[model samples]
Target: MKAYIVSLAAGVAVGLLYNVIDVKSPAPPIVALIGLLGMVAGEHAIPFARMVLAHVTS
Candidate 1:
């Protein structure tokens, strides 16, 4: 639960930082949401890739 909350806060901070950097854009919120999802997916993918690599090597 705590990790989830921290992830959420980090995502929000990333989103806000992006918006601040590109204040003229109108899609900051969507970009932020996509970024959050990407982060989660990427995290899961790393271990999956590592497992695959080990299996292939062994």
Candidate 2:
């Protein structure tokens, strides 16, 4: 989606900037990536749980 593309572009830009500055990234890359994954999963978690609960109750 558009949001995903924009986020990816922003991340790439930040990465390039970090490389140019020769400074360590603010967070470890693996940890940051996992945190982002958790955020995406968390966004859907509530809606998916509600759908399942509604089906069960119906």
Question: For model 1, how does the per-residue alpha-carbon lDDT over 1-58 read when each residue is reduced to its tens digit?
Answer: 9999999899788779878898554445877889998999999998999999999999
TM per candidate comes to: 0.40, 0.51
In model 1, the worst 10-residue window by lDDT is 22-31
Residue runs of model 1 more than 4 Å from their true location after superposition:
1-28
Roughly what TM-score does model 1 have, to 2 decimal places?
A: 0.40
Instruction: Identify the leading candidate in terms of TM-score.
Output: 2
RMSD of 1: 7.8
lDDT of each: 0.85, 0.93
* Clash count, one per candidate: 0, 0
